[model samples]
Target: MIDAHIHLDQYDQTGIKEMINKWSENGIAGVVAVSTNLKSSYDILKLKQEYPNFIRAAIGHHPEEPPPNTRDLYELIDLVHQERKQLAGIGEIGLPTYKKEELYTKYSEEQFIDVLETFLRVAKKENLPVSLHAVHEEAKKALISLKKLKVELAHFHWLKASASTVNEIVSSGYFVSVTPEVCYRERDQLLVKQIPLEQLLIETDGPWQHGGPFSERQTTPLLLKEITTCLANILHIRYNELLEIICHNTKQLW
Candidate 1:
């Protein structure tokens, strides 16, 4: 199975080789490693080169952090153009939620929106799918921008939005991902119910610690086994069948 979204670059290099080998032996097919910044993007691209068949790369500025400087933004755009053939998608981009209050101390919401829209335009022009972080109330704004720009493929990773918004996303044919939390979090379980199986993707969002059973565990694609198991039960499909469908869903996007 594919890990639909993860920050592979954030992992310590000490034993990632062994980690990947282990995950592969356990049945992991590939991962869509997403980037948080320009440097992260370059790192993911390099990883893609090393594991061409095992890593699908997506790159963009994550919205919860400080925006990239103008020069870096332009350079990132240029890099996308130069390496378009190598990228799987544009991602980790969307409106901020967890850091919006702190970010507003220096950057206005409008500024963030502009930067996000700029990247959205780039994604549309590049004709690549998008991996987004938009959640809660801000998800609506991000959806508006995506529709306005006519981006055809997008995955709303770890989405948290109103029932109406979630339905709208499904109706719009956008994909939504659930993390390992679905095993213990009611919110995520309910979310899985809201999205059609065809639009559902599973991710670990690794290196971002989770609570409950995942507490203190170093997140990795290996956790996808538990996530897939939980989802199969929730969706009431056979384990192998659900795995096949979700794998197809991930492939249908990136």
Candidate 2:
């Protein structure tokens, strides 16, 4: 099994290391540690070096941050080109749901779109896959743009989009990751129903959005099997079959 996406830098280093070691012990192959900023992207690179076979890195500026400068985007592109084989994709990048007034207080929507466009261009140039964070209308727009790019794979996590948009995503062959939150949240379950099993992948999105019957604490990749179980129940498929599909998707992207 593979944890398609996670934030290794967000967890306690020692705990994360131990947890990953345990995952290896449990027969998990590898994980893609994504970046939400420049520093974290570099950190992901270092992690890839440390765990060459077990960790893959994806570099991009997340929507939560102010849009990056052109120089920075160029540097990121250069890094991806130089380290193409080591990277899973360009990710954790897209538009936010904040209104224009709120967005301008930190960064303009135009700037966010610009950064997204830049990242899309880089992803196309590198012929790399991408993971997105946009929801609803924004997600729709991102999907339209991605279809025009050279993306090989696309994973949309924790989606909160309209049914039409979700349908479009599924039809377009993009994958959607269901987190453990599905076990406890009706909204996530609704999302699970909307996505087909072939396009569905399970994720932890660990250290954030943690829920379920387990400990009410931070999430980790170890809990991915729980998500798979929830998905299997919802999709009415065997657990192993669902696991195989997710593992295949992870390999296709990373």
Candidate 3:
């Protein structure tokens, strides 16, 4: 099994190493350590250097942060391009939650759109897929922009939106990853029903969004089995079959 999205950089250094050892013990193949900021991108790169066979890095600024001005956008593009092949993809990037009062005050809608557009441009230039964090109307807009860029295999994790929107994303041939929270969240179950099996993937979004058989206290790649089990039930398929489909979808990104 492969945990398509994880924050190995966010875990304690020793603990993360142990987690990778455990993943090997449990037959997990690899993990993609995604960046939420420039620093995290470097951290992921360092981890990849140490465990090149088991970990892949992705570089990009998270959309929840304050919007970048034109100069800052260019700088971010340069940084992502510099690490393009060393990294698996460009991501953890997309629109911010408009309803969040703090994010709203930090960045206006127009500013957020501008920053997202910049990210899209970089993804296209580097010919890399992106992992998006979009929900509701924001999800719709992000999909539209990504479609225009002709980026295949984009992953949208923990998506919260209408079935029609999900259908649009699936039809676009993009992938959507289900997190462990799906084991308990009804909305996530509905999302599972909406997405086709071939276009679906599983993720932990770990060190955060914790749940399932592993200690509820902390999330790790070890808990990915719980997510895969839940996904098996939702898709009405055997566990191994679900794993095979998700693993294949993840590989398409690289």
| Highest lDDT scorer | 1
How many clashes does the backbone of model 2 have? 0
Query: Which 10 residues in a row give candidate 1 its minimum summed lDDT?
Result: 11-20
Better of 1 and 3 by lDDT: 1
Q: After superposition, how far is residue 49 of candidate 1 from its true place, in Å?
A: 1.3
Q: Per-residue alpha-carbon lDDT of model 2 for 54-151, expressed as tens digits?
A: 98788988886777777888888788888888887998898877554566787767788778878888888777778888887889878877876646
Encode model 3's per-residue lDDT on 79-101: one tens digit a residue.
77776668788878888875447
Candidate 1 per-residue lDDT over residues 1-254, each given as its tens digit? 99999999998877778888988999999999999998998999998998898999998999988999999899889988999999999988998899988999999999888988999899999888999999999989999998998987989999999999999899999999999999999998998999988999999999889889999798988899889889888889899999999999999999
Error of 3 at 22 (Å): 1.4
Best by TM-score: 1
Displacement of residue 216 (Cα, Å) in model 2 is: 1.5
Per-residue error (Å), model 1, residue 60: 0.6
